[model samples]
Target: MELQQLFLEAIQNGTMEGFFKLISYFQTQSEPAYCGLASLSMVLNALSIDPGRKWKGPWRWFDESMLDCCEPLEKVKAKGISFGKVVCLAQCAGAKVEAFRSNLSTIDDFRKHVMACTASDDCHLISSYHRGLFKQTGSGHFSPIGGYHAEKDMALILDVARFKYPPHWVPLPLLWEAMNTIDEATGLHRGFVLVSKLHRAPALLYTLSCKHESWVSISKHLMDDLPVLLSSENVKDIKDVLSTLLSNLPPNFAEFIKWVAEVRRQEENGQKLSEEEKGRLAIKVRYLKKFSKLKGKKKA
Candidate 1:
């Protein structure tokens, strides 16, 4: 199938069947290079989230910029090595250990490969717990990282688990523990528990680490139970403040009511953080640059 036809069908069908159909076609092509295979794979994985017909707003996030910034093969030549040779070896049918091991020369390349596959719909849970605080930058596009993929991924997981898993596997205590970890990690654990009982995983993890407090720590937790939260609701009050603001939020404030409600509920429940919260909670945030980078500025 043609790429344009696949995109059009994906928009109308709301099923990623066409996307994967094209991916399989690409994967089976003779002498397919890693660039083509990897690029198609990323697009297939992303479009499978079904962003909805009306929500085609920022679908381009799945394009080349994402690949250039996050794909390991793109960084192969950056280390004074030959990208051509690497791509050639990757295309070969041989499973030679030396060839694959050579590709791990740079830490960035190694991590980017891991980032490409982790947090996918196949092996992990997609985050669905919404904080309900949407920021309107008054810009034409949404925040650099904002999208509907999170909700779509979660819905897909729930649909599968509801029919696939047994009753025992869907117990609340297991989900509650996962939810607790996500909450401490993201302050959205309560939302996870309230939203889904099957699994608790953050939708956007390492991809948005550029906006995180510590990219290293955030990267470490990419596959962990911790949740990544983003809301589209309008922010109304000070309670809606994010632990990290990617940028200055717009004047619209109604989007944060959901987060405010969660905070109020947690307070009412006496859910005060213990020792873990004291030590780890502070590190979870992506500290504001003006405060952290400015000399002699206090860390409040």
Candidate 2:
């Protein structure tokens, strides 16, 4: 009853600037919920980091900037994107960032912080939460807070995992509760971070130039096999076929990518694959489907 009252009151008193921003901003994840990656990408995009650079919706490993920032080789398709990586990627994009993990001592403190932060046009906020909210079905995910209703105290979670959840008003208290948990990989409590204005670093620009071509080459290979892999029956088949193809490839190239290239060629030229080969081809296509949305997006 008390929470209900807050919602009614906040509906009348609060203003949601971030929710308004999402109409023009809010790009979905490039692959799964690289929530941290995608949310940071949104903030970076707001800061005009990539400008007009077109990003094909491929895995982060195919993007020089994102791959260089993430640690685990498998985080491209797996979970465990940490707070440190978030800070690093923001810095690389020329945004000064500060990460606050499980540090909000009180609901009012957290609320005040969020309210004040959004007041600024000079920076953007990205937050992480455990899956207790959103109907209790997901794990940790990230998104920008778009609005805050002062009377009701509901914060708009501009979920970047668009396919999974829509932008909704989560109560400030519940959202805070969701954030107060440990990331198994980092042993740090989930919380929010702020990314300030952009100013490109000389070194950051240099790194992109050096690694740009390698990523482009990687993307080409994945795109070829992507459609067929997208058509696979199940994940197990995708994994098994990719491994079989990987074993025969040269050491320098990524194993799954080589498999993907083969799948692409066979499909494009209309050659038939053995049942075993067909399964492998489908794996590439499945993962490719994951990134199709971000192809034209500069930030992901």
Q: Name the TM-score of candidate 2.
A: 0.57
* Tens digit per residue, CA lDDT, model 1, 63-162: 2222222335444323211222322322221111121222223334322322222322221112221122212111110000001122222111121111
Q: Which candidate is the best by TM-score?
A: 2
lDDT of each: 0.26, 0.62
Stretch of 10 with least lDDT, candidate 1: 139-148
In candidate 1, residue 218 scores what lDDT?
A: 38
Task: Judging by lDDT against the true structure, name the best candidate.
Answer: 2
Model 1 global lDDT (CA atoms, 0 to 1):
0.26
Give the alpha carbon lDDT tens digit for every residue of 178-270 in model 2: 888887878888888877775643221112221333555555545665445545534467577666444322233433333343443454453
RMSD of each: 22.6, 17.1
